[model samples]
Each structure stands twice: as C-alpha cells, then as structure tokens.
Target: MKLIKKNTERGEEKKKRPKKLKRIKNANPSVVLDRHGNIIRRVDGTEHGDEKRGGQFLAALFEKLIPPGTKAGNKKQKTEMRKKPKRKAESEYNEAVPYDFPGDIIRSIKNTAGDFAGIIGGKSPSAGKAGEEKRGGIRDAAPIRKLSAIRRKFMSLSKAMRRIVIALSALFVALVSVCALNIWASGFRETWKAREASDAEKAALESILDEAFADERSEKLRPLPYRTTPAKLDVRAGAAVLVDTANGCVLYEKNADRLIPPASLTKLFVMYIVFKEVEAGKITMDDIVPLPELSWAVNLPRDASLMHLGQGQTVTLRELMAGLAVASGNDAARAVAYYISGTQEDFVARMNAECRALGLKKTYFVEPSGYDENNITTARELAEFARIYVTHFPQSIEEFHSLKSLDYPLQKNLPSWQKNYGDTLAIHHSNTNPLLGKLDGVDGLKTGFIYESGYNLALTASRNGQRFLSITLQGQGKGTKQGNEGRIHDGTELMEWAFSTFADYEPGKDTSLVFPVPSLASKGNDGKFVNLVPAWKNKITVPHLFGSTAKDSADAVKVVVDVPPYLYGGVKLGAQYGSVKYKLGEITLETVPLVADRSLESAGIAGRFFGTLAKGSLEKNR
Candidate 1:
C-alpha cells in the first residue's frame, strides 16, 4: 500500500485520496430537498430505492415543495421511518412480560397507543406509503378466549353463597333456644331464701278472739230478752236491724226498709240522721223542735202508742232522739222531721236522698219513720246502712239507745213517764230489736214488724280483729210478736256461728316455706348456685269451715316446691321460684336467699414462697 499525505492545520504536506463510501447494510434513510426542486441529500445512497427509507424520503420532498404562502406557517420539514427489528426467542424469554399475555389486554394497549401517536404527528394514517403502512396502523390480537374465562369465575362464587346462608340460619336458632332456657330457670330460684322466725309471737295471737269476746261488767254488751205480745206485734211485712259496737259490722237484719209500717225500726234511721246532724253542727242536742198539731193524742187508737207531745210543746232534739230509739215514739218521729225539714214530706225527701248517697241501692223512703205504703229497704241494705252508721258514728248508740225512758216535765211539777216503747205487749210497748242484749258486741239498731214484708232482722258483731254483719230477710215470722221468734232465733244463731266457727291464721315458724327455683333456668355465673327471691312475704287467713274436732283439725303444714319445666344448660338465675302451698287452717311458709359461695385465686410459686416466709417471720417475732 502507498503512503498517503494530506494537508494539516500545521501547514505540513499530507498524502490523501477520495474517501470510500461507508455502506450501512440495514441503515434507515430519508431524502431532503431545498427551494430548487433539487434533492439536496440522498440519505440511503443506493441505485435500487431502500424499502424502509424510500417512502419517508418522498414524503419529506412534498413537504418542502409547498410554497410558504400555501400553508398556515412557512416551514420545510424532514421525515425518517425506521423499521423495528423482530424480537428473537432469547430476548422474548428475558423480558418480565411473557409472550402469551391474555389476548384482550394486548389489543386494547396497541389501539390506544396508535391513536395517541397519530395525534402528535399531525398526519392521517392513509398518508403513509404501502411499504410503511404497518408503522402507521396498530395491530391487535383476538379477545374472545379471555371473556369466556371471566364468566367461569363468576359462576363459582355464586355457588358458595348458598351454603353460607344455611349455616348462619342454624346458628341463629341455637342461640335463641339457649336464651329462653336461661330465663325460665331464673324464675324459680328465688324461693329458696331463708327467713327468721320466733315461737312466742305465734302463741300470743292464737287466742286473740276468745279474749276479746269475753263478757265483763264494764263491757256492757249483755242481751236483754223482752216479752212479745201477739195482739200488738202485728206486721203484714216489715224489717229491723242491729249493729255491733266494736267494728261496726252487722249483727242482725230484717226487711229493714220494706213499706209495711213504721212499727218501730224506722226510728233507728231517724235517730241516726239526727245524731249525724248534731255532729255536723247543723243542729245541737239542745236545739228544740216544736210539736205539731197532730203530734199528741190520748185514746187515739187501740193499736197506737202514746207519745203525749202537746201541740205547742217544745222538746230538745236530744230528747226526741231518745224517745225515738228507746221509746219508739211515733210522735217523736213527726216532731224531729218537722223541725229538720220544715214539713214531713220534705223530711222524707231528705231521708230518701240520704239513702241514695250512702250506696243503699235497694232503699227508698216515702216517710221518715219507714211507715206503711211509703219507705222500703231490703234486709241486706239495712244491714249495710247500720254498718256504715254505727262504724262512722259510734257515739250515737250510747246517747240514744241506752236510755230507759224519755221522761221530762211538761210543767214544773207535771212529770210524765215516756216509758220504753221499743217493743210492745197488748197494754204496753217495749224494744223489738232482736240483738239488743242477746249478742256480744251488739249495740243499738232497731227492730220492726209489719203486714207487707214479714219478719226481718239485721245484726252485726266483732270478734278478735275481724267483724261480720248478718242480714236475715223474711224469716219464718209475721208481724205478731211470737212470729218474730224466728227472726230472733236466726239472728242469734248466725252471730254465734260467725264468732265461734271461724278463726284467723298467720304463718307459724315451722310452716314458713318459700317458692322453689328451677336449677337450669336460673341466671348467674353458675345457674345452679343462684336463685330468685319472693317479692313479698304473703299472709292469708282463710275461713276454716270445719269445727274443733279431731277430724276437723287441719294437718301439719306442708310445703311444696313446684318446678314448671326442666332446666337447660344456659338457664338464667333468679327466674321464677315455684309457689309455696298451704291449707286453710295451717300456717304459711317464707323463703330466703342462699349464702354466697367463695372462690380463691391460686398464688404463683414466688408469691407463695414469700407468703410462707412472712408468716414464719411473724410467728418468730411474736
């Protein structure tokens, strides 16, 4: 090879020759042009046009041909298209993304990327030549297979949901059953609690009735028997009443408000109203009532009793009440009514109004004295009235009923005997009240007999702490005095039976029992250990119908614990304890709480050792 020389920057001679062209085997190329329609640059430099760069070079040529005014901006541009080499197997395996991506995603990525590229280049796809068509268009793979796989996964998830629903339902049912059992057991546990009892207290109250009913001279409840006159004691039908002084219960009753005759019992209600009036301060015992024109008479009728009220005579309200209750004076009734009401009819209206206000549902008064064709009251109604009157106004009996007579002088020396007119014989009247002196605890109420209603009696009495009222209506008796024998007999018998046959009972120490708690149903940390307690210590005293005989006596108290249902594992503590059982004459049982159980915590080894050492040290020091 010959040495070459070339001119150098140092002005030294250098040998040189034309430079050989550097051929690029696969080089991408383009053609450029200037204003003269001349190819200023031939980038590929090949006789046969290079497939890759030929289309790009021709596009650039046309861009430069446009005159400056032909386009929006005067500019000449150049373009080059480079072919992307195919990825070989080795390169494909080296990439993190495998060749086989799911078909759907690959197609979407290419389509989106191509659209973005075209917008930036400012050219439509059709502007690229046939050989460069692939560079401009995006390629995508089919996506049908990927869609099928997604559908398969959805079906699998739906199948699992049904099994989960069934499992949850079963769990819910089991939870409810456990709660129900816990509630049931808690109800019964309350009855097992214990109560303290004393023996001496029980015996003290046992004979309370017998001592209360005992007769004493100062007690003043002895009954007085009166002789009855068949001729004068005439009642087509009638009623009567007697009341106990102690608790104000009824002791005897007759047809107390039947319109038969104002034989005598009507005086009781009249006296009651008068006593009430005085107590209310409307009138005083000393207040005087003027005698009416028809008040007094001598030899008026064979059947009539004498009151001897002069037409112009004035008597105190107290004396009139005494004459009415003790003497059963007809004139006294007229006198008191006229003074209180200004007229007899008005006074009777007051009586009727009084009866209605007292809840005496069956009573009606047309007259103050309960005389014939006027006033009517049932035996039961009178007994109730007597009960209320005597109970609320206890002082009236002593003031009115105990009087032997109502004797007051009309003039300074003219003394007249008012005499006992409660019950009458053929020639004289006497008290007709059946329970007057015959029953213990009995006090003042009145008695009557008439043609219309028959014999009746109302009686009330008290024994121990209990009070009873008995009413007998239309007994086997007529108005005749002997006919009233039935009334007296029934009244006495009934009062005796009420006081003697029945007794009140309280729970004894031995008999006090409690309700039982169901073991499974009670609620607590441990259901078996906890119990419900009774809300109250109940006491019941039922009537003992049997007598005091060996057979009649009640058996020893029996306590039974009733469990309604079997307990379950999750039963609640303090559920219903069962009720205690007892007989009428026997004592009742009380319940109490069970004592608390204690639990101890275990100590660690180090703590236990120290505790033992401390104890030993303390003992040595002591």
Candidate 2:
C-alpha cells in the first residue's frame, strides 16, 4: 500500500511542474529552452531566453547612470524603491558584503550586463515582430548604453575627484539661492526707506502748518497796500532791496526777488541762530566749545577761509563769533554749529526751520558755512531776515560785525614750524566788508563772496534816527580788485541815495486829517464822532530827493482807514479800534494804530434793543 501511495504522489508533482513551465513559455514567447528542455539563466539572475527581461535589466543599469529624477520608470515603483527599509546596522552590513572585485573584473561584468540588456532591448524591427511592438528600441538603447559607459568611467575616478565634484555642485546651488535672496532684500529695503521718508515729510509739513495758524482768527481781508508811482533810483547791484526797519516797509526794490547764490553771506543766518541759542540759554558766549574733527577736516583747506583752529583746541564762543563775523572764518562757523547742534547737518535743518517761521519763501541753506554754492536766497527775503536780526539781536552787530580786523586763534595753537611753513596762514584777518568804517552809520551785518555769487552784502545803517536795512546781491566784477570794490560801491551808493532822498515826517505836525467814527452809545454825545488818535506818535518817511515840494509830499500821501463796519457799545478808551495806513503813491510808507479817545457804555438793554431795531429797518429799506 505505501509503494502505491509514493508512485501516485510523484506522478501528481510531475504534472504540476509541467503546467507551470507551460504558463512561463506562454508569457515570454522568446524564452529559449536548452536541449534538456529546461530554462537557461544569465549571471545577472535574468532569463537569457526572454528579451523583455533583458530589456528591464538594461533599464535598471541605466538608472544608475542618469542624473537623479531623469530615469524613465513607473513613479510608484521608483518611490517604493527610495523608501525601502534601511539596514539597522548599515556600516556593519556594508562591511560584511565583501566587494573586493578587481577593477578589470568588475568592468567586465558591467559590460556583459549592459550588452545583454542592449541586445534584447535594441532588437531590429525586421528581426522580430515582438521587439518592434515594444515601447523602447535601439534608439532608446543607444543613449542608455552611452550613459552606462559614462557612469562606469565616473565611478572609476579617484575618491577625491568625486568629492570635489559633489562639493562644487553644492556650492553652486548655495550661491544661486544667496544671490536671489539678496536681490529681493535690497529692493524691499529701498522701497521701505522711501516710504518712511515721505511719511516724515508729510508729518513735518502738517506740524508746521498747525504752529503757523494756531492763533489765527477769521476776519475780513485787509486790502493790500497799493503801489505808488515813485521815483526810480539808479542802482548797479544785480539785486537790491531797501526796507525801513521800523515798520517793515519796502522803500525801494530792484530785481529784489531774483534768486542768487548767497556765498558766505549765509553765515548771517548761522550767526542769527547762534544768537537765538544764546537768548534761549542753550549756550553762552563765554562757554568753551571744542573744535570738532569735521571742522578741522573741512575747513583746514587753504581755499576755505578759516580761523586757523588747531586739532584738539578749545575756544570760547565769543572768540568764534568774532572769527565768524569779523574774519568771516568758515572754520569758526562750523565749530559753532557743531557745538550747538552736535552736527552741521542738524544746524542746517534749524536754519531751514527758521526760514519757514519767518515766511522766507525763496531761501535755502545747504551748509552752515555757505562754502557750497547751493546756498541761495533772494534780496528781498534776505533784507527781511536782516530786519529781524537787527531788531532782535542788535548787540551782535555792535559787538562782532563792526570790527575792521580780528586776531583769530587768540594764540597760535599750531607748532611754530607749521605756522611758518603754511601758505598765507593768517593769525590776523581783515574784515571782508569794505564799508566797516567808510560809510556813516554803516554798522554791520554780513558780507559774502564766491566766484558764483561775485560779491554780496547785508548792510544796516541809521541816519536821522531812522534805521534802514539793505541787501545787495551778486555785485559785478572779478577778484578783490574789481569785484570787492563793485559790491562796496553799489552798497554805498544805495545807502547814500536812500538817506538823501527820504525824510521822516510826523503826521501830528502835518496837515493830514484823522478820520473819526460816530459813537454808537455815548451818553453826552449821542451822534457825535470821536476823533481817532495814533496809538503812538509814529512818523512816516516821504521821498523829497527828487526836488519835490511839501505839497507834492502831501498829495502823494493817501490814507486808508480800516474800521469795523459796525461798532458795538462797551468800547473802552485807548483800545485799538482800527488802523490808518499812510502811503506814498501806491506804496505804504507806514501804518499807525488808531485808538479810542473815550469809552462808550453798552447801550443799556433798551438802547441795544433800539439799535438792533434801527439796523434791521435800515437793512429792510436798502
């Protein structure tokens, strides 16, 4: 019975094996069978008989040759291959795999493997229908074969060479990323800075407007002073203006609004700021100010006017002012600016602020020293500035500006050798202004010169108890010989003409009529008018230099009175009720405040009721 069972089992096993072989043959028709009727396998574990398997093996070889992500394969299969579990002890596992094949043997194995795959994958179309129907042919296999060759050659390189290639590739990628990031970051930074600057400017403008109009009230517009037909003065200045310091009246102007380079005359504003600081007690004349590094670096050049300040030297604010006003020392100016604001740039900002406050429309300062030609202003605006300066800080002119010469540095702080070798090193400097002692009552204010501005002067003088301020900008000629003389001559001529032509006239002694408004609620004088009197006995100057008589002066003067259209009761005595402007032709020579001569009680309740009724009736009738 056991023998019969064994024979049956062997028969069943033999039948099952033949069925499996039949299925394999059906699937790969190109599979070759040996003489023993068994399948043959290559060294790479692929059936030598099946062309499709050979093609798949060739694709696997080529996968190693191509750059990453360039392989042709099913995405799912590739991803699964990448995610294959890593060995727990990878180092030990690699060490256990003895890959000690000789270079030539290894190369031979790779070549055979590639050739086998290529022959099956790259079959000619006429050779077999099955190969022709396959997706890849010799066209595809050709590139793969080449890639394999290249990969083999790369693997044969020295270890150091492979490492160098990998490092260079990484460096290239890093550089690209950094450059892209830098470009984006730089653009963003610039845009942000511009936005911030615009916002700052907008805020500054708003603040300035708020401060300027804080105290303003809505009122009826006053008529602008009419321009009078006046005698034109012969003047040689490129631009000239003359103003009465008492009332801020423009007596004469020629090309007064023309823009011109201010040159060192810009120091006038610097000194003005200095005086303001003194008044505010931020600094004092007796305080010691250190000579800053920037002052030495910028003003030590021979071309720049300087006070010959030495490195690390300390100076009094008073001495610096003397250098600035009398010697026109640019170094002294810079030092003072730095001492006050910690930087010349901040001082320049303060200057522009003052300009805005003073309503100077056409003035700008680029530097405190005015060494740069970019500093600019109009004659009319500068004359106005001088008026303010003299009115507020008259002592500045008296103490610092009238001097003919000043000894700068007080004592030579430089070594004897440097002092002697330096070219035209001046411990003493003569004032650039030529009219210091030449013209009567010509006290101050500033003089400026450069090739661009030629020569300029801000002059103030008092004659017959009336102070006049004048500005002469851009005088003609070249060098000290012609240019200096031309400016001085022009300024002298303007001052002489101004004082000779105009004489101050008091209206009290003149035949001018003072208009009186009728009192609305006065008890004794019910309909009587009260005579208006000047708040102060102020005088207006009239031009008499043209051989004009007193009658002509009287005829030239026209009065414009500004009185409220309606006066309510409860007006107090000496209260300003209106203003009377005295004009010579159309130009206003002076405006005097008109005051009440007597008080008027509020029309008692009944009086106010009747007054309102009368006003309503008058309007109804009109």
Candidate 3:
C-alpha cells in the first residue's frame, strides 16, 4: 500500500511540471525566476531566460538547429536554491551580459550548425570540418554513426516529396522578405517625397511683408503663395484672399494688395476695441449704453440699417453688439461708438489708432459703421487683421457674430417699448452674412453693400478645429438677380478648394528628449537635467492631412528633437540650444528652433570643474 502511494505522488509531480521543449537545448545557464513565477517579462523588461543577443536572422536560424538534450543541474541543490532570497547581483539579471554581440564565437557555431542542417537536407558536408571546429562549448557532439543513421533514413524517403517540401519552404521565406521590404520602402518613399519639395512649393512659401501686421515685432506670417496660383479658379472681385490661419498659408489670392473700402468690415475693428476694453475691466457687457441723440433711429439715414433704439428704450452693450454684428445696423454702430467713446469722431480716431497699432498700413477709418465709403483696407491687410482679431477674441465668434438673427428690444430690457406694445413690437432681422447656413461651417463675420465698396464680406468659418479667414472686396452685383454673385462665387469656390487641398498639421506632440548633465555643472541647481521649450507655436498647414497629431500618421508627419546628451556648463535663456525637426518618417519636412527654458550658469568652484568634464563628454557625443 505504501509503494502504491509513493508511485501515485511521483505521477502527480510529473504532471505539475511542464513538458520539456522538443527542439530547444540550453547552451548557457537559463534564468529561473522565483518571486515572479508567472509574468512573461521581468521587472527590467527583458523576457525571462532571454539572454542571447546577436543578429536577429542568425539567432532565429540557430535556434532551430539546437539538439534536444540539455545539461542537468544538481536536482537536490536546485530545489534548495529557490528558498534563498535574491541578492543584489542576481536582481540585475538582465544587465549581466553586455549588449554587444559575440563575433567569432557566434560565427563558428553557425558554421557547425549550418553543416549539420545541410547533411539532413541531403547535401554533402566537407569531411572532418565539423569535428575540427568546437566553438565556445557548442559542439557537433553526435558521433559518425548518428550521421550514417540520418543519411540512411533520409535516402529511404521519396525524393520528389522532399524536393516539393524544400521548394515550398524557400517560397515561404521569399514571400515574407518581399512583403517586409515593400512596407519599409513605402514609408521611406513618402518621407523622401515630403522632404523634397518642388520648386513650385518653394515659391508658394515666400514670406508676406510687414503690412499684414499692426506691430513691427509681431511674429511674421505668409498669407498666400507668391507663385503657383491654383488653375481654373476665376474669382471676379476688386480684391480677394483665402488663408488658413493655422499655418498662415494662403490658398488663393486676387489683387490682395489693391486698396478698397472694407465696407461694414470696419465694425470688426470697433468690436475689437470694445472686446479689448471689456477684457481690461474698463467696461462690462452688461453696461448701459450711453445713447446719443444723433444715434437715434429717426436720425439715421433712411436707407441705412437700424436697430430701432427708440425713445425710452433701454439697451445693454451686449444687445447692441448682437445688433451691430447681425443686422449690420448703422444706428447700433453709432450708439456703440458713442457709448464706448464720447463721440463718433473720437471713436473713429480710436479705431484708426488700433488699426495702426495692428500694422494695417493701408487701412484707415473716417467713420465707425462702414457707411462712409472712404474707410479703406486691402484684401491682404483685412485677411491679416481678421486672423489677429479671431485669435485675440475667439469667443466673440460664438457670442455675437454667429447669431443667425437678431430680435430687437426684448421685453426685459425694453420696459418702456414693451409696456406700450408688449411682445408684438419686437422685430426680427436676419443676419447680413449671406453664407451663414447655406454653406457648411460658416459663422459670424461682417458684410457690407455700399455703392462705394459694392458688396463686401469678411468671412470666417471653422470645421473640425481648422479655421479659414477670407476677405472679398467690391463684389459686382447691381440687382437681386446678380446679388453678391462675385462675393458668393469667390467665397464658396475658394473655401471648398482650401478645405480639399490643404489641412493643418500640428507638431511637437512628444519631443522624447533625453539629456544628461554632469552634477553641479548647472547654475542655481544641483540636478543633472535642464528644461526645454519650443520657440514658436507647433502648427503648420499641409495638404490633405487635417487635424492629425504626430502620433496618428507618423509616416506622413513626425517631430524629431535632437538634444545633446550632456550640457557643457550653463545655457542662456531663450538660446537656440538644439533644434526641432518636423519629419515625414525618416525625412525632415521642416526644422524649427528649440530654446532653453531658463538661464543656466556655472556658478561654484565644483560646478566649473564638473562643467569642464561635461563639455568634453558633450563634444565627443556631437
């Protein structure tokens, strides 16, 4: 009965242990993890028992040639070793071997294993060569009889069957190699093409002049390509431009530099001044508008648009802005101007001051509401101002300009008017912007129609976070049948072309920057790293790839940061310490400047000494 019990226990132990691998034999000591018994990867990230490091193709090839038998450890001592705690030296199991490959030793093993494999496949091996070479403990240990047994067994088979198997194996390997090469080459080609821009593309990227900016020190922007205008686009306007604000690339332009009246687009600057005042806490959106007698509905010109701010009517700054933007009301603009400044003349001066401040060299205003045809700006200048305006006050687009219609004198604010007629007196006025809902993504912006300026629309739209700013001046429309035909045609055609042709590409998602600094080598700090920052906004407009981060389509566009491994002493603030490269896979698309976050100095005696060492190390890395 005791013998039966002992036999049963032995059988259970054999089942608990795994079956030995049929093809692999351990040539070196294999890892045996005690604490992490089930995890495939160890703490340092190398796979357990995976110490062999060499060429991938060679390693995979040699793995199959290893014989089945493995050298055994002392079974009794192996069991006892598990009870001992892991030592400091044992914990660094992955770093035990250096990362470099073994040269001659590995080559010798491959020769021996390769010859043995050749024999199995019916190819004759050079006699005595396998016996002459025994490399680094890996040997062809099989005797001569074993070779005879393999040859005889192989000869007993059908030769045609063996040849067919060999052909299939070779074909499989060839197919895999071809597939891998195709994938690699495809990515390489895209990167190469993106980096190699054509002569036409270079002409398209020429910089615009300082006229687009109000401030001389502001960041420069290129509105449109100087050359290579899109073919087949027939835009008939006195002046016109379509620009992507993300990378500031111009999609289309016609007489962009020609001077023309901005029409009601002048209200854009008035609203800009008001928003700036509001942000500075000088005024609030709820402030009661100081209504002047000249701004009254009865006093405004007969054909002019009006918000109907009648006697005893109370209006807030917010309501007037909505009316000014939505109705293109001359009364609302006059009242807003008077409320913000004492008189229309003073307010117009402020508008001109703001224009000059912004660098609108060709733009000046004599009146606030754009009723006067003499107020001037070019298509290119207006486009630049629109970009700055939208960037400065993004919320105004949704709050005021985007309203589809304006209902004047709401009962709550118009107590006197509402008390007389209640809700019946409130009049609905449609937004002056014609492109609002008729086209996708159209939002708030001002439009004007005067004999001096014809029909003008400073249009802006956004979809999926990509925004376009356009200025169309002097649309030729005399009657309802010809109503804003030029402006509408130019706006729709250019917008559709821009959206289809180019999209914004955001850069510098993850710099993946790593640098080492010698200790005590930096000013005011004892650490071994310095902080880094980008010198400019990480956005550029690219064709047909919109709203994508670098991680999404890395093959089309990626950002590579080349940071030095060590800092040689301290760095100055805003210095160009390294570079940020925008790449399409392996090829660089554009290179921008990268700067240090703060100033660093080699302050102390110890710092200077270590800084010298750091300098030597950094030079070697370079």
User: lDDT at 198 for candidate 3?
Assistant: 35
lDDT of 1 by residue, 1-622 (tens): 4456755777787766666433222222354444433344555453333434444644554455444453434332211222356655534443533333233333544444554454456433333433223321232112223334333322233355436544654776687765654454343334344222224423332233225333321122222111212222232323444434342323333455553333355666777778778778899888777677656644234354445555445567776776677556677788889888889888888887887777666677766654454566666566667666766776766676644345543342121333233223112234556567667766545555454545555555555654555555555553456556776676666666555544333444444333222233223433332222232232222333466631232233344444333233332222333444554333332232221111113345653443343333333332
For model 2, the stretches where C-alpha displacement exceeds 4 angstroms are 1-232, 297-299, 412-426, 506-539, 545-601, 605-622
**TM-scores for the candidates:** 0.41, 0.52, 0.60
- Model 2 RMSD to the real structure? 33.9
Measured on C-alpha atoms, candidate 1 has an lDDT of 0.48
Go through the candidates in order and give each one's C-alpha lDDT: 0.48, 0.66, 0.66
lDDT of 2 by residue, 1-622 (tens): 1122235655652222222221111222333434433456533346655434444644553355333563354455456555658745535533554333344334545555654565666653233244433332113344355456555544554688657656765786798876664553333222112211135534543454345333221111111234456547666778988876755667778888898988888888988998999999888899988888777744465788877677755568988888888878888888888988888889899999999888887999989888898988998888878888888888987799888788655334444555654445446788878887888988887888887887788888886576777898888875777876876787777788767766666665544444455444434433234545555443465766234653346446766768653355556555677887777766676676666555556777776654453443333332
Whole-model lDDT for model 3 versus the true structure?
A: 0.66
Tell me how many residue pairs clash in candidate 2: 5
Candidate closer to the true structure by TM-score (higher is better), 1 or 2: 2
**What does each candidate score in C-alpha RMSD?**
24.8, 33.9, 25.1
